[model samples]
Target: MRQTRRIAETPPPEECDPRVEALVNDLIGRVADKWTMIVLEVLAQRGELRFTQLFRLVRGVSQKMLTQTLRHMERDGMVTRTVHPVVPPRVEYRLTDLGASLGAAFCGVWIWAEDNLTRVEDARARFDDRQT
Candidate 1:
């Protein structure tokens, strides 16, 4: 049995095609949004969740923002929405394989942030002091 280490390197600029670069940049912009990242994290952890459950789990997110974020994720094929028909419609959202992969990829960013938090706070404090 072998354990594999995750690599966080990016391809060199010359190796990236312009169109692909543009699309990747756009996708990064979308997925890097606070709400999107939070939603991805929650779904990755909780498996499947109802809209209301998600709203509750994702603290401080408004119902409208959750709805919008879920729609965008579904549109991007990152999540699947299942509607259960009954007296009251029950809808649940689960991450697609693509979404799970994205969450795994973003884990590195979370790690980086955690590792750099103290440094970042010091830098911010210094900058604020200089501004005063």
Candidate 2:
């Protein structure tokens, strides 16, 4: 059985290319990771942030992992990394229009979760009860 409703049973929806589908899957997988969402949230709230600032703001994430996430975001054209030539070399990151739009889109998910928290909790409780 299909989990998602299909608008039509025959012809598929528009923009169903395999390459696009694979890219969407890869990007979605990356965004669904714990650190990516938190970093996106922190950057969205705080605007531009330096390496140390991000490390501090996004607590519990190691420096190495943060570096990787930032790199991935940069490669995806979601974030822009600026390097400042200074005594210690300062690098700051800010979200591009794409990243900002993505953040805004995910904000809708947060709103939905907040709106349905009680219903979701009730469902979870009912599921747990059945397991026992």
Q: What Cα-based lDDT does every candidate model obtain?
A: 0.91, 0.91
The number of clashing residue pairs in each candidate reads 0, 0
Clashing pairs in 2: none
Task: Mark the 10 consecutive residues where model 2 has the least summed lDDT.
Answer: 4-13
lDDT of 1 by residue, 1-132 (tens): 855534366445566789887878878999878999999999999999999999999999999999999999999899999999976999999999999998898898889999999999999999999999
Can you give the lDDT of residue 35 in candidate 2? Answer: 90
What would the per-residue lDDT of candidate 2 be over residues 1-132, giving only the tens digit for each residue?
756544485565576899887887898899998898898999999999999999999999999999999999999988999999998999999999999888887787899999999999999999999999
Top candidate (lDDT)? 1
Tell me the deviation in Å of residue 71 in model 2. Answer: 0.6
Q: Tally clashing residue pairs in candidate 2.
A: 0
What is residue 3's positional error in candidate 1, in angstroms?
A: 18
